[model samples]
Target: MTMRSILKSWVERYFSDEEALILLVVLVAGFAAIIWFGRMLAPFFTALVLAFLLQGVVSALTRRRVPHLLAVIMVFLAFVSVLLTLAFILMPLIWNQLVGLVQETPRMFASGQGWLDQLQERFPNIVTPDQMQSWIGVAGREISQLGQRALTLSLTSLGNVMSLIIYLVLVPILVFFMLKDREALVGFTLSLLPQKRTLLTRIWHEMDRQIANYIRGKSIEIVIVGTVAYITFAFFGLPYTALLAVLVGFSVLVPYIGAAVATIPVAAVAGFHFGISEQFVYVLVAYGVLQALDGNVLAPVLFSETNNIHPVSIIVAVLFFGGIWGFWGVFFAIPLATLLKALVYAWPRGLEGRQTSQVPPLKQD
Candidate 1:
């Protein structure tokens, strides 16, 4: 076939299904909205996600014959209780540990410098005094800047207090309303689309089930990993146990990279505190066990068969979306990739075949 004929054939094959075209359009529009209004809509998006996380809880309550509104109210109350407890208790403890870490920076630097000096003595040619000094100078500068930035942020947090208050007030309200009006909201959304939406329904059903499973699984993973990490760190008498635990917990968001990156702080704290002592080794072993169990046991039990995305796709998604939206992007990367994969496979194909089967072929012109 000529280039024109081939192009025509390809288009016919892909574009024969109206459902395919509609789906593509919807995807494009949805992406455009996110790209254009991402920051402005951050709170709404956050609220939506929060509602989704709490939805299972509300559903469970309702399933036990609790009234829907009553269930929603109870779930909302529980959510607020957790939020308030974190803000009042957990956050302050973490903040104090953070402040303590910052205060100990000079000691860490001095300890690091001492190690460098010893290394230089052991390998004079490989570790010149000048080069060691230069590297230490750079590190010291960076650490100083980091400290300054952290201090500045903490000091200026008062200015951002209004924004935080707004988020604290608004997100819960939005979540509450969303939960209470879930069916009505869904119906209104569906009413905007075409009456015939077989493909759309299929995709939505699949996405809903998968996204729900992912959110639930991830939440459980975070809690379990964080709790385990905190217990291990405390058992080892590691400084900043609460703060490090929080980091380790969230680090699971990025899969392989998260676990690897989380090791740095854990190692740094361990090394500075215990050097190469048996306690340090024990700490490392405990952390390793936590990670192993999380990967080998917890993950399998919690997220079995939920994410069908390949490892390569997941990493790429994390990098691509993390670059765009940072932490939240990384957190949602796997689910978004799964959605993309589902879309690609679900996209109607063989349009040309369908048409050929339905209509008589025209004579060659």
Candidate 2:
């Protein structure tokens, strides 16, 4: 027999079904171990994500004849400036509102109790006042307990806070190196793969392209939503317009659930302060219009050009990742899912009957 046939026969004979199952179990356990031990790597992963997102800006600067180091510095400075500007502009507004809310908590609590009393009165047969009070007491105690624990944790995590500061300081440094040596990194990573898996390298590059496009497209969509939200809120004379606009914009980064989550607080505040009739209706209508515009217009225009992911797939990805990693997972769900899709699209089963093409020569650094 030929060497290839002999090797295949030996593999088939030695690798039994039991061995395959054992290997599968081993892989699953290894993955679990990695995930369990991965928390310390979160900051690095976060930095990597940021670097990937800012790569376009770095590339643009480089294309403009800027030196790589200067390009990295400019991009980093621009990002920091924008963040600082937003903080300077919006922190005071949010802080003032938050302080007002805290000061008025007693009155709000009274109002809530009054509403509960009215509900008990209306449904005396179904829900007794005593039962309602018991429920409220339990809820209050739980909230208080949770708040205390959260406060304690925050106070105890000063070192964590310092670590975060260090991470932030290091991010730009890491990003600079990544941007400057991106091509070299790509080449090195690709070289690590066996020659037989060169196609996988090409697939990975395509996946990267998709990821970059998704990031750029989503950013543009966020800006559009934010601008529209700001305009609408300004027109409606909403309090904290800038802050609310920003909330809406940032929330858009989370997809469908994000819009609803953002709208809830705004709607509740408007309704509670201004009554549930006119102001509530106006805010609801405004958000409804914005959602419609986002779903039917902005998303299609932006995502259709690059990401053709199905809505159901997006939802599944959100559910899966959100369940696994909480908020951060949800934040990255779509990009991750898109990368997976690209990989699957390039898999052997996915590429059956596809024609081979001439491989391009690697560009010299």
Q: Model 2, range 1-365, lDDT digits (tens) per residue?
A: 89999999765543433433343354477457536855776666666777888999998888999998898888888877765665466656765665454455445556667777887889899988789999888856764675566557657766576775676577656766777788898889657544544444555577677778777777788788888988988777766666677778878767777888998767755656666578669888988999888889988777774667787888899999878877667777887787677645544433332323344568999
TM for candidate 1 is: 0.91
Candidate 1 off by > 4 Å:
1-7, 123-131, 349-365
lDDT (tens digit, per residue) of candidate 1 on 1-365: 79999999877666657877777789899878777888889889999999999999999999999999999999999999998888789999999999999889889889979988998999999978989999999999999998998899899997988888888899999999999999999999989888867778888888998889988899989999999899889988899999999999998899888999999889889989998789889888889989999989998898896856678888999999899887778888888898888877766433333455779778998
Backbone collisions counted per model? 0, 0
Q: Give each model a TM-score.
A: 0.91, 0.73
- Residue pairs with backbone overlap in model 1: none
lDDT of 2: 0.71
Q: Runs in model 2 with CA error above 4 Å?
A: 1-37, 64-70, 86-106, 112-159, 227-243, 350-365
For model 1, the local distance difference test gives 0.88
Report, for every candidate in turn, its global Cα lDDT versus the true structure. 0.88, 0.71
Q: What is the C-alpha RMSD of each candidate to the true structure, in Å?
A: 3.8, 7.6
